[model samples]
Target: MTDQSTVHSVTYDLLRTLKLTTVFGNPGSTEQTFLQDFPEDFSYVLALQEASVIAMADAFAQVTGRPALVNVHSSAGMGNAVGNLVAASHANTPLIVTSGQQHRELVIGEPYLGNREATTLPKPWVKWSYEPARAEDVPEAFMRAYAEALQPPAGPVYLSIPMDDWNRPLSGFDRVRTVSHRVAPDPQRLRGFADRISASRRPALVFGPEVDRSGGWDAAIALAEKLSARVYGAPLPDRAAFPEDHRLFGGPLGMSVKTISDRLAGHDLVVVIGAEVFRYYPYVPGDYLPDGTALLQITGDPAAAAAARVGDSLLGDPGLAIELLLDLVAEGSTRTAPEPMARPRELPQTPNSPLTPPEVYAALSRVRPADAVIVNESTSTMAQQLEWLPTTRTGSFFATASGGIGWGTPAAVGVALGDRDRGVVRPVVGLIGDGSFQYSVQAIWTAAQHDLPIVYVVMRNHEYSILKSFAVLEQTPGVPGLDLPGLDIASVARGFGCRAVEVKSGEDLEREFTAALSAGTTTVIVVPTQPQKAML
Candidate 1:
């Protein structure tokens, strides 16, 4: 089956076999050669900037549950994509990132556009990085990157291919190769873990992003319900792992270590499924867990498991592990309910009045469809959204776990593409903050071009409200550039070719949102609001 032909044809055939026919990128001069005569079966998704390229790939991969191929320009473009790269790495999204290198002959001269040491740039963030030694090794590198990215603790990998490598004659890579995505736990360890679950008096289950990523949401819910375990989401979860409206759900844990330790104090056993034992922020020194409380984590990341601050870890396929645990626990597990946790309720909104986030989120709760997919980057308003618009569907809600901004806009567009590609016709809603919206504002144009039915709710508070909270918390006074003066989001959306409207009042917010949802096109609803002091 050796092609013994140009590397381009062989790689294209291999990519088609792997079903990685979609490529997202923002091309540059150096990348032109590789992109020339691109195959018809492969569709190229264009983004305005390199940063949006990675964010779009992030959501696309998560939604499809497969590795997404991303192409970017040379060194400068790679630099532009670093923020989103950090976010994707933090969430462990499987992305294969390739950047075009300058001409292979320009090695000693340090030519104008040449990236001398290309592999060093994206390191520590990407799982693997390389610039292939020979032109013929390009396809092999890509296939290896695919397997590396798809492996556990899956993260983005980088490949910097020289511009001329695309045309080199290749061989021995013509056959299709299967890639493995599942890892089963040791039978002895699984049984012991199940015994622990069955023996614990008051157990708690903390579901995480992988529950959505690995299709373990139902298994997580079943385990929680079977043992009357209170379900809490991992801190600042990137995906909704459990039904937020379910009786056993206790909401997301706090990012503060002491806060989390205090919340789960009474539970005798805390079993975290498909998430790290703890992901903390705003470092508050405290005990990792309550005294006498046992913490167990089941995850695919060996690094995370080895580095866990406290407790035991079981490595395996999360979906299968949960199923096994469910079967084992059923033999002898009793039920007991925990005390109900109080959730914040929405305040009543006055007619024709300026809307608050709580009011907008509440109205969204009332109007949001059961199957609508949400891409959230409304940082200051996240608490309100979490409180009012509780997500019930697994994989329905997506956010950045690394606290990166500018991800939602492009991610929404990419999720729309993913849905369309997978033949799922659900509405996509993007919740973006005014500050975050400005970062990747151009992403709106892609949605407009595709006429994707996405409703973008711009929470226009005109300030970096989260940074203001950070200023206060750190006692760093006189922080400049927190307030964004006189920037019109509606005008910006319109400039990007999206139908835009500014909603000043609660009534206007409700009515306009209802109209936008069924508008059959990409629309941006800018809801003006005053900054809320509700800091995390």
Candidate 2:
């Protein structure tokens, strides 16, 4: 048992109250004092790199629907973790990220590991960042960090603690406080919003990552059905907010404004929920909406609302807003529900010589468990993956919201662990590209060590196919460094203590993937796939 008199003990007590017993980290010399005599009840998830640390914690927080604690070394470690921190912020994953600082007495002299500009380093990306003014304030700082990380538009928060502070005597104990996570929409505004939807002849609903993040799948479907609306997944969504197979469900929206406006042109009213007004790219020059259409957006993020180019914005918890709209909006309306967008025809089930991405995804879909979770970073083959392997369950799909590669591979590890801890364990399937896999390849060690049931399929296309697609889109020929030759992901996984294999044909992929699904330990299946240009 820890002594309650020390700052460490008191802080741990508060963590226990908050049920944040799972800590993800990579240790360093400066953090040793704080980690001394670690509590037996806490689970310490170790990652080989700080980048993987943040990604793992981000997925854990996303899976368990709770803020996750992350411990890193110092400034150098924080610098390494910044890339994934951007992903976590875009994903809006609530993370309490703490890093150790140099000894208080030596900090003034600029010791070797002192975090110069500690609070400024992780700025803009983090919701809040701070270092305790006094050693006694360390516990209080942590408490405040927890609150800030869990508030609306939840994102990662940072805290820097001096290595010497953990052993400092506690002046007194601080009481733990409960904080509300959701903000309800204004009653008057919501009533008007519902009225607008009810009056629309052809209404459309566009769902985003937040719908799935906020556990609003059922509410979203109900709201859509009540309005007899066509439902489309938001543009470039990081999570699957609707079941692709649902009759009312349309395919994902395009990333460019022109494409989106064209797709929703027929609809008289479009209601975008739980996402930014629009996440556009490639400078698609066009009107934000069609001539006969009106747009309304409900989002938890005020910034998203404010930055929206064309929309009547409402600030509230998107899920709750949808639920409330169900009550206010007229039901059993005579408006004709639009036909669902045509789904891609299923490819031939026969195995191929050099497997295609669609073929691989189809084979996996055939053998994949219904409840399995998919974390994908195979950017070039995303459209194929979504078509062949539809996500039917809530909270079953994860990807990087920042359009960054490398987060998915490590994220799958955390998803499996989080699912296991939450008592709803499901098989985790990682569809990772060869280039994306290499970004944080060391993460496989953490999964292997934990023996998480994750099947990592390395889609080896021997090049950065996504970049080549971009080159194609921009008409930029002869781009250098697009090819990624001589990468053996299977060999790397083996070195990391995972069950690894190389599959050449679709039959072998299906066979190995089926076996890996039931395997107790993590498996890496490296299958060489035909390169395909990505469609933006």
Best by TM-score: 2
How much lDDT does each candidate structure score? 0.86, 0.90
**Candidate 1 backbone collisions, by pair:** none
lDDT by residue (tens digit), candidate 2, 400-481: 9888888998999989889988898678999999999999999999999999989999998999999998888889999999
Estimate the TM-score for candidate 1: 0.96
Scanning candidate 1 in windows of ten residues, the lowest lDDT window is 346-355
**lDDT per residue (tens digit) for residues 1-536 in model 1:** 23457777777777887788999999998888778888887899898998899999889898888999999988999999989999899888999998888888886688888877999999889999999999888888888898899988789999998888887777648645667888888889989988888888888899888777889888888888888888897888888888988888887787788889988998899998888878887777788999999988988888778888999999887888888888887542455686676885938645425577887887787778899889999888777888888888878999986788989999999899999888899989999999999999988988898888999999888799988887887789999999988988888888889999987766677788889888888999998877866445
For model 2, name the residue pairs that clash: none
Error of 1 at 534 (Å): 3.8
